[model samples]
Target: MEDWYYKVDEKFLICSICGYHYDKYAEYDEENNTPFRVEISGGYGSVHLETKKGDWIRIYLDGNLSAGELKAYKNVFENCNKEKSYLMTYEGNGFFTIHFGNPPEHFLISFKEYLENLPEDRQNDVF
Candidate 1:
């Protein structure tokens, strides 16, 4: 597997390969400095993965993810075992699923409730 990284610019969060953008600031709260909601659609709301052939594949997350949920995703991505885990998108679906391990374990991940409520010790456990 090749090294993969992502960057968050003023407008978008883009991955190294393909440079596909994801997570755009949408509605803001009264403070205006913090985003209350984020838009996740089209190529702008997708995760990019490099294939063995050096091509790129995208997992589109259509809909909205709260700031907390977004942070949870970032934590998981940053802490997970990159070589063993992958993010997957189901057809006609708008959420991301995490897959990992030798036996090929998988789980559907959506909303802030799931990720944010994990025990503090297990918060970074992505497997």
Candidate 2:
């Protein structure tokens, strides 16, 4: 229902849930005083997100994403309905690995349309 961001050092994120970093994202929980889970781990260039509740999520770019792609993905995060789907930037570039469990196939179709509706600048980065 709310989104927040924070700058985090590399050591803060851990993959307790997945047991590994996916290179594009990672997450940590400070309430427990340790990492509760991490996403998109084991990559070079990473994007970190921290919530007001002291929870952290990060995506490691690993040089797979270009400037333009990253820009477009930022747009997606700003525009898409976060409640309806999950997005991951594990491989970087604008190409997101999305998971939509609600009405699964329908959500995928909607996501595809979301991409199609993007301006050319954003569309090109999806690989």
Candidate 3:
């Protein structure tokens, strides 16, 4: 995941559930200290929603997202969206979808790849 998308998704999740909206983490032009909403960072994994006015209520996930805490995550995001915060997730498919605004974003996360990256049985602890 791109670094800034986490922040965007954080804000997106908050907006989707709480119905509260604000652009708290506007991009900082450190050299100029100017506030610029980057909208979509790295062309993926980020959305620079310029306006702080919105009503995001209800978020959910389907598809290959079947397994373990993925359902819990879906429920949490759904409740949060109903309460008006936001998020998405899935299981072994190694991918999930995140919906925001006019369009949605799909992400990939390979558990097998992650396991391979881990040294020895360290992957066991990940479960």
Residue-pair clashes per prediction, in order, are 0, 18, 10
Q: Least accurate stretch of 10 residues (summed lDDT) in model 3?
A: 41-50
Model 2 quality (TM-score): 0.22
lDDT per residue for candidate 1 within 1-127, as digits (tens), equals 0222224322445432222345544457565567544443343244544444455444556544466765665565565445543444333355434332221222343424555767778766532
Per-residue accuracy of model 3 over 1-127 as CA lDDT, tens digit each: 1123454442322222112223435566576566644232111122212223443433332233336655555454443333223344333343434543333321233446655777886766553
Point out the higher-scoring one by TM-score: 1 or 3. 1
- Residue 4 in candidate 1, Cα distance off native in Å: 21
Clash number for candidate 1 = 0
Best by lDDT: 1
The count of backbone overlaps in candidate 3 is: 10
In angstroms, the error of model 3 at 78 is 16
> lDDT (0-100) at residue 82 of candidate 1?
51
User: For all the candidates, what are their Cα RMSDs to the real structure?
Assistant: 13.8, 17.1, 16.5
Model 1: CA > 4 A from native: 1-9, 14-20, 23-87, 95-107, 119-127
Worst window of 10 by summed lDDT in candidate 2: 16-25
Residue-wise lDDT of candidate 2 within 1-127, one digit each (tens)?
A: 1122334433333332112343312356565556444344344334444444455454544445566876666665454444432334335353335422122243234446866777989775543
Candidates' lDDT values, in order? Answer: 0.44, 0.43, 0.37
